[model samples]
Target: MSANFKVLTEDSQFQSELSEAGGRLVVADFTSARCGPCQRIAPLFEEMANKFPTAVFLKIDVNQCTSAAASQGVSATPTFIFYRNKTKLDTLQGADPETLEARIRQHYGDGEGEEIEDSGVPGHIDLIPMINKAGCECLNESDDHPFIQALTSAGGYLESDTDEQLILYLSFNQAVKLHSMKVKGPAENGPKDMKLFINQPHTIDFDSAESANAVQEIALTAKDLEGELIPLKYVKLQNVMNLTVFVKNNQNDSETTQISYIQIIGSPVQTTKMSDFKRVTGKKGESH
Candidate 1:
């Protein structure tokens, strides 16, 4: 329960990590030490812990922590449960590594899947509410192509009817350090070049994007468009308030462009919790 991956022997430790602060995603594996499938999937599960550095990975032995397993409705060995902000998102039973990995990437990003030491996983804070058109022009800007749709729904997307480029302005509710980003869409019509301008003016246009000083410009490949986590230069994205992404063009010289999903992974510059607040008294001298 202390490391990125941990064994939960008691119910107390299990509950504590489940409710840990800062809106983290927790993945719990319920297994019996004696089960053959449980034994088989152990290494793959551990590899997932390393792959998802930002998620809390827990392996609970049903025999050791019976209360925890029963409370979570785990009746079978090698069951997996995903939780974020104390709410259950999804669950998987048995030791299917492909399904498990896909589920993890669905909630998190698809970073380099290699198993490495946990430097840490970036927080996946939903930023759809903070988006603004700024200076964007799209031929199809109706509800069908709502910009916010691309940020959340994996199946939903925003498309440009007039041209191949689309611009979006993201102003976070709080400052965040961007670690990585994932883009998902059709292969041929997917983005090829993306330019990021940090804390820039909202009046940025297609022409302005060419002249404006770019913090980073990424030459995206097919792998990136298919939901791979493209890690950004970490140092350049510290304390970011507003970000601008200018999609230059698509892989194919298509007249229209499509983006099914866009995900940002980062941590807030300062996280304020309601539990940390206390009422202040104005009339201390007159109060009884």
Candidate 2:
């Protein structure tokens, strides 16, 4: 089911019906027109409204709904609240699209489908946790970067594909640890050989320190998604440049194989094991 909800500046139904919307999967945005944060989250809230039509979604302008804000304990503008069966499942303050989607997936459930065998599908990493969909389109070709609550929400999967290439524009201050890349072989449904690179200023030349996290190269045979991380003691990962990968299909066919499309996810997801580095059965585009 799909839905579109338009919450006006002054609506009396919210207070009386808030509890009615409880436990039914609701994403409420407490916003104000004057506040920049409120406006920024508006499109994202509505986008989610469309994606999860089965869920109740609405927005309350803090400036107009003073009573509602007070009743809901909204002390700030653009505070996102998720209610499942009228019970508060999650909350985000000063959040972005990606932040909202992540929260939704955490309390609601991952939109990133089930695990498959070595199908060669790639995985994604949401480098910026604060922005729900910051890395949302690392390598996505799902109808362009239109704002979808699932894509812009707190913790929604950005893009889902078997062959993908990701490019991330980062802020050194916020990124903590982001070494998980999604990739897969043609036969393997999971992700495979994943790589990361950084672009920094030439004055800050860093070399021969892999542990320092210049960048990380990771590979996987199966989906162990969460475990010990590949060490960054010698890599030196401060100044970033670019990140790229070739999730090619080397399958033994008479014709060549070239990727037609790609999808990059925003957050770190675990749907498969393998990676994007290994050779594929479809070596169609070997020349490229």
Candidate 3:
């Protein structure tokens, strides 16, 4: 029961450490100090490590420990890997919090071998949803995005097993890429900025210039939103119902023109009124 982090120098050392992990769990976080996305999610894994102190928590710096990283096939920062009884269970290659969390949950389950925790939702954050509905009027963006019927609440969601994409053609005062993709969220007086979390579960406020988000910050108006805007952009999804898309009015704004509705239509991506979403989904007059 140790949340210990060790830097491996060679493949043999890494193997020895893995075997030493016993029957507990091994969480290998392959990261470097220079990775912005790694910095964003480092806190999340830290929190999980802390939450389950009985496991082996390691932070392998890919830059310094070349041999170990190369052996593990880790060329990127913030790669989370799992091993049970020295056997690899799951591997998360990107900085996608939702995807990472999903993989971790799958590996950890309720307990490792014998230990058990009664907490229903273990080591996962509850993020608000932006578009909370089932079967949006918007057409299916990917084979992954589907209407989740067993959710505690229905919303625009993608199954954890799916690597699908959904494009949200909405207008924001500012738009930036989380890593390299173009995505938009509430800017100006719209809503609180999304947080970049990892091990310790931290948040980068809308105004803060943090090491999170690898790509340069660009201003994407309605015209800038291209490709499929993933639901994972909003929530750190693990389960099908884990994705949330809720937009509440900013209390500080005096303008009555908050977000009336969230719509996705037309080429590339288009921002339409909420009425269209409700009319299309037959959810008119209902609040998210």
Candidate 4:
């Protein structure tokens, strides 16, 4: 085992580490000393631990923790399991270095080594500041738990009034290029089916939202409701002044949809300001 990563010999240790990881990604390498491929990939796995410092890396010996291996269904040595908030995101059975690295980058992203692929856009940033709070509204929401509570306040949550459906309307102070969004909620009552509409002239009701064409529609996964950043269609959400989110239902067919937190990530579109325009008098009325 590498000195850089912690080795888990007991199931309790594994559970403890996972609990402490919270929302951070946890990569567990189940290996045995007798496995030839495990030895080959140990060095590279250690290097990844150093490279992605933000993620928690662990080495679990299958022989030492047989119960833990059985629980995770790790029949083969050198099995890599990816987890976040105690939920398994992905799993690999082989010792392929490229594939392992690709899987890590797929979820957590490469820290500063990450390359910006979107042309003309600098990078993604928190677009919550650009939201026009006064214009924001949520239909079928409880009076005590308004939509703004989910966005603006910490430890605040939004609850539906009567049904599982919720229509959230948000207008931005300026045009923005939306990258992605995060919606956090309970596992059972979280949003399941979602439709996103951009640049709508006014707030859309549930009927119009269901009938109208949406920019992007997605079904939220278990990990997504646990605070994973749900990506948007980059090409479609380029110049958005407003966004409408329609929550069609909950995961467990619950009566009310509950949303605890909402985060919008994007960059504000750059446009010429009035201050940038210089006053020209046509050379002292020469043209007149």
Most lDDT-accurate candidate: 4
User: Which regions in candidate 4 have their CA more than 4 angstroms from the true location?
Assistant: 1-122, 271-288
Candidate 4 per-residue lDDT, tens place, 1-288, comes to: 433368787878988897677656679998888888898998899889887777789998877876666667666778888765555556787889999998787556324332222122234555554577777888999998889778742577999999999999988876878888888999999999999999988888889989988989999977898778788898888899999999999999999999987878776565222234344322211111
Candidate 1 C-alpha lDDT tens digits along 131-221:
3334333323445676756756545788875778888777665466787777888888888898988886554778888777788999888
**TM-scores, in order shown?**
0.53, 0.36, 0.36, 0.52
Q: What is the C-alpha RMSD of each candidate to the true structure, in Å?
A: 15.1, 17.3, 21.6, 20.5
What are the clash counts of all predictions, listed in order? 2, 91, 27, 0
Off by over 4 Å in 2: 1-4, 110-288
As a TM-score, model 4 comes out at 0.52
Worst 10 residues of 4 by lDDT: 279-288
- Model 1 TM-score relative to the real fold: 0.53
Estimate candidate 1's alpha-carbon lDDT, on a 0 to 1 scale.
0.69
Q: Give residue 13's error in model 4 in angstroms.
A: 42
TM-score head-to-head 1 vs 3, winner = 1
Candidate 3: regions farther than 4 A off? 1-13, 112-288
lDDT, candidate 3, equals 0.40
**Predictions in order: lDDT:** 0.69, 0.43, 0.40, 0.76
Error of 1 at 272 (Å): 12
